[model samples]
Target: MNFNREDMNIVIVGHVDHGKSTIIGRLLADTNSLPEGKLEQVKERCRRNSKPFEYAFLLDALKDEQEQGITIDAARCFFKTEKRDYIIIDAPGHIEFLKNMVTGASRAEVALLVIDAEEGIKENSKRHGYLLSMLGIKNVVVLINKMDLVNYDEKVFENITKEYTEFLNKIDVEPKCFIPVSGFFGENIVDPSNKMSWYKGQSVLEVLDSFEKEKLPDDKPFRMPVQAVYKFTRDGDNRRIVAGTIETGRVKVGDEVIFYPSGKKSTVKSIEVFNGEARESIGSGYAAGFTLNEQIYIKRGEMAAISGDIKPKVTNRIKVNLFWLGRSPMVKEKEYILKVGTSKVEVKIEEITKVIDASNLNNEVKQQIDRHEVAECILKTDKPIAFDLSHEIAQTSRFVIVDKYEIAGGGIILKELEDEENKAHKENYKWEKSYITLEERAEKFGQKPALICITGKENTRKKAIARALERKLFSDGRRVYFLGINNTLYAEDHNKKEHIKRLSEVSNIMMDSGSILIATASELNRDDIETMEAAVNSKEVIKVWVGENEISEIDEDLFVSKEDTVELAVDKIKSLLQKKNIIFKPF
Candidate 1:
């Protein structure tokens, strides 16, 4: 049967042996949703095996599940009510398969948590409840199954409801309703049950139909994690396209867009389609592609968002609520891989704020996160990544952790933290401002402010060229200054890296006064240049290498040979600055 986008995803989760599969099978059978004669085929197979037929057998398609009487993976079954269609995900309830459970539940818009009335609340039941909360599923219905075994006792149902309700509340989950069901007897599943008149509520089918379809995030800001950047040179057609499924809102041709983590800006030139008429705009859920007005360096991992909307946070440090499922416990200072959206980066647990006992709501201070334990912790990535908070946009907020190339944990970002690099930028922005703005200063000085970094190996005459350039510019009625790296050497407990950082900050401050600040540092590699670029205006940082050989992978604006005298080298550098418009050339 064809299903539309309004179809809802509902996940069934509970402890092992909690009749989760049985409930789904009964729902399908009672509603006449099973395939033609598939029910009879299963029944006949049971008879041939000399076994009594169970509703759970209809869904236990795998031989291992039938043998062990437990699900090992998430199974999807489609059913329809008159209101809308549903994709019921039967998530495995075994604790060992909790990761599988997460995978299933993550796709669901609503959840139905099952608990065996005879067995009462199991550890897995509460654990699943906590996971439902963490997974951002707000709509939940608790199903107390096997009420027939308890003789449909109202007292037993009420007691289980009260206890589980209290437990769910601790995790900030308020279940929509509590249902007592007997999949074996088909009571209160599709039809009202005469066996229990004490209960007054809709049946499972009615409850499901009552649920409104989860509204698409079309009203939010446009966000699309670039899945791929395609270049089709076939038949001499040259078009660089950015392609991905929109996670929220819409994008149209001519809209200004910005990519985060790199902060590149561009305009949507045209929308591309396959064998269809070109569209003017596209919204969430469309796997779309577009050409840009300008060629900017955008990779697969960056978030392309509308420039005017709420921007996604870009940072290397973040706080998260995560659960561990690895064989080895998650320890502090150990490296792992964090995958969010299309971006995957090396990550590490900075600190475990606390480990939570999901079954009982107990908190403990721990150095490591054990299997099946939930925790709130700080995570540090090797580089900046773009994402939203869980409260803001959950689609971009969710992440998974891979340990040893295997998925070991999943979580949502609580918030982004200000790392040292970000803090430095923030501090730089708050520096004292003069009444004369930088623009005014630039107009008076007739030169745009810039940081010219002269870098090369030790004993390469970098300082001499920097000083000579400063002298020439000052003599030519220009604002210029030369600072050496060693000036900040003895500043209170600063290391080599910290010294470089200080030099960058000073350059930033000096550049704010509309002066061409020329600085020299020995053996400056790509990283050092990047650090200085981050602290100052990246576009204004002109890198000049004064050596015979290249050291690292640095993008140098000018390369001077050791044989070239300092004066000619200075003249070449000056000509470059004039070409770049950093300084005005003589008329």
Candidate 2:
């Protein structure tokens, strides 16, 4: 088979001590890709440690790795078969290093799952396979290594291969090729082995060389997520270039494109690459900058796609399938930072709809998602961010969740909720009244004053203040709706953005009802505080500061002591309510 110089990235993955590194080392050595004198240095180091020379040492060249005899980090090694060049990523097999494994596997186009013939399919081996599938890696080649330890027995290889194939079937990963080889003995790797005459399959190198590289799709709609904007002054020429890798499809010199989330439109003036102008059109897998005919506003992470093909939607609510890797349990009502593509937005878990059992891919009904558990949960962001479904667009659909500067989870967007009525309903308030509607009561009571309570931490104090103020206002016969800071049931779970959006919705409800809106929340940031202030009825919102320090932004001396109980505070607030000329009868 003829091979072209296409870029093929392969990841070596399996359980620990499954001869993955050994196979890679042998592949590099047999292909003459190792640097001169590097092999001799490894050999000397092995001898100094009183250890026999191992092929795996060639790849695990790190000193720490040599001491521990375990690969702690993913290592990338470059080599070439006679047909094509390859960048081989050796992923760690330990379960503790699963994050590192994901880091490596994310860059690979194909995976090489190594299995020991004697041990058959193991825990990490199956796990790596399952993760690869989740990452959308469809190309896999299974290698049954350590055949020499089994006396190169064909029956042993066949039995293990059959068992592994069954396990892979359960996970829905059909390997393109399964080869039996001994990396230590240098058999069935670079060349065919005569010892295993029962096996007539191609060698490892031959199979890899023969595998067809999937071509980038060119017929789909053009999508270029703007990564950067460049203004270059060279040789007295001023040029503005919008640069990013083409995520999918193709674009030409005169195609009309739109910058999303902003809805700005422009026509492409020219496509520029580093090596000068190209004669043909550029498609996916190429990073090129384009100059637009009209100077329009475009920023990083903004998607530019062919106009009228597929419009990007800005949504606040999204459903995602998450894989948690955090130390603490993913609790409801907490907020976390979500980084998707180039946007970092505040997000909250709305609900733990269901937890997924990774072992069998079954949904487990639970309230919390613990570490190492996969779940289908709903996430709501503070603002609308452009995204596509995982099946529709994998590049823009994936995201990572960070809490306290560490990546706690990663997930893919499953579905984007787009019903405007449902969106409004999710953010609306439903209240039961006694005598009159809130608007009529406020109009009748001669403008009942409103109270806005703000705090800086999530604690019982926030809720306690709200309840106390509500009771006092009720006693004074004022129309009031005490909006608590509980957002756990809003969006399938308590997502931070959803919670904040819920707060915004409550503010709107207060404005529409024309009632005294009293909101209590902990750690309300400057922006959220401003949003709440803007949404309340200006004629009635009585701003109440209920914490230690005074919020200097809002010009009001409504500071209430944090130590006061709700009843005592209500008495003090009642006098203030009377002085403001606000009166209503208790219902």
Candidate 3:
């Protein structure tokens, strides 16, 4: 069904008991949008049970009680004005139902966040605002609901608006407007209320009508994350259809498409659909599937894009602006599943840059993000996934974190970061072979080549420990070298991230040359360790913590203390090397 006016999907959100359902019921009733006798049937049931009538009852338990405003689920109803038609999504407001709320609001183009004038801004009020921003729903209108409870006072509305507006601004969400309304009394709902003469602006119906329909992003680069590959060969059609909704730009027959992170290319052979006209093209916002000329082994979680236009970035590391809703604190090292469009990746928190309290916009430096806290952090995925930056493509860049089968957090991809696992170094596999192999080199050196990284906080003697071990090995006539921070940073590419990569690369070369390389970096963390390991090999890399490190992210192969004697530290390191078969005991 099509409407002459713009069609919109709007989610009504706020805290529990904040009158979201009441406003939805009032809008449907006021606009005469409900089905025939649906409203009366509900009222009659209420009358039969001798219960008070509630507008919220129309929404929850559609076949059951009318008072069930919240069944802890997101439910949709239809309503329309002369200007536009709406699919009003009633998102659950209870804190336990956050996942349901995200499911409803994630697809909404606009949101109406209700607040109780008497209760003021509550916890979920600020939280929902934060979510809308992260979900890329910038078109929001705040409703200071239940003005009748506060006697339709203008000052009360103004005060609540000021406080809530300030909170939204902290999360970088500027609401479109604030409206005062009593959903129960129908004040400023469909029609402006004479009781609220001071509210001279548009009514709720007017604002709903005035909101510009969310336009499809047809002009941007074409991106459709591969949701599935279908081979319906049994139905006399032998086409493999690659399916997903186009997040941006358009696609036409014969267009050259590239499946990314893999960088494989294919051409669109035909537009496949259940039943439609002989369509030659499709654009963004359509759930389109296409048959490729050549069936490449592409799978879900890889994005399909049009070649020669803008391309999606392929990387395993990204910096995100995220909100945590997990019952447990979002601690580093805990693996979580991140879903962006059709891509699902195993991800771990690499760093917590900053955690912001949504209620007061207070920024704190914390190692973990607790439930309902917002944070800026870096994430390292198990593999690369294709994506555009959040600011560039809102639909494809936003993602949710799933912890234990529940959406524990949601965030937007702010930036792509360089990872040690990038394919740039994969070219080394093409190098010419040497007759004297790694095993021969190890036999000549009398020890297996390994990269030992000593990491600790500043003034913790990490470098001292690394130098001591290198000296002990050198004294024993073993091939060993120590590279400190200044050794790697003495030249160009001295940034923290680049330095880590360079250190790992240099260590890999030295190890290949039959010399054990001991490196020391005070700023090293788990991501750096992973990068170092990826550069060389995990089994060939040994991590030793020199002092107190609070994070549980990295599992060190060995631990030393500042109080341990240098000779004792060296002895312990040699013992571990022997245990790992990196070295053999000598007479």
The lDDT leader among the candidates is 1
For every model shown, the clashing-pair count is 0, 16, 1
Candidate achieving higher TM-score, 2 or 3? 3
lDDT of 3 by residue, 1-587 (tens): 24356778888888889898899888877887766687898899899999999887776545353355534112334677777678765457433334433322337878899999999999888878878877778789999999999999999999998888777877789888999999998899999889989888989889888878777889999999888878776869777789987878999999999988766688998886557754689988788799889766567777989989988887899999888888889888889999877888899999999998866668899999988898999999987788889888877777788999978887788999997555555444455646778999887878898988877778877877788888888988889899986777756565787788778778877777878888888856656775676667677888787776433235578878777887788898989998997877877
Local lDDT at 207 for model 3: 86
All candidates: TM-score: 0.77, 0.67, 0.71
Model 1, range 1-587, lDDT digits (tens) per residue?
44453578888889888898888888777877666686898899999999999988877653444477653322333566666667775456433233443422236778899999999999989888988898778889999999999999999999999999888888899999999999898999987789999999988888888888878789998999888888878999889899887888999999999988778799999998766777899998777889999876577788999988999999899999998878899998889999888888899989899999877879999999998899999999977899999899888888888898888888889999988765767578686777898788878989999999898888888989999999999998899988888886885765767887889888888887888988888767655765787788789999899887643345578888899899999999999999999998979
The prediction achieving the highest TM-score against the true structure is 1
Model 1 Cα RMSD, 1 decimal: 6.5
Off by over 4 Å in 3: 1-5, 61-77, 94-106, 423-587
Superposition TM-score, candidate 3 onto the true structure: 0.71
Could you give the candidate ranking by lDDT, starting with the highest?
Answer: 1, 3, 2
* lDDT by residue (tens digit), candidate 2, 1-587: 12445657888888778898899888877887776666788999899999999888887674445477653222233677666778765446333233433322245677888899988787667667767766677889999999999899888888887877887797688889889999998899999999898899999888888778877757667777787988878897667788987767898888898876556689988888977865346898678989889875466767788887876556768888877878898877889988766667789888678996564566778988977678888888866677667787676677778878887877778888763433444444344434556657667765554656545344537677677777766666667777766732454575654575567656666656556667766655534543454444344545566656633334333666778777766766666666675553234
lDDT of each: 0.83, 0.71, 0.80
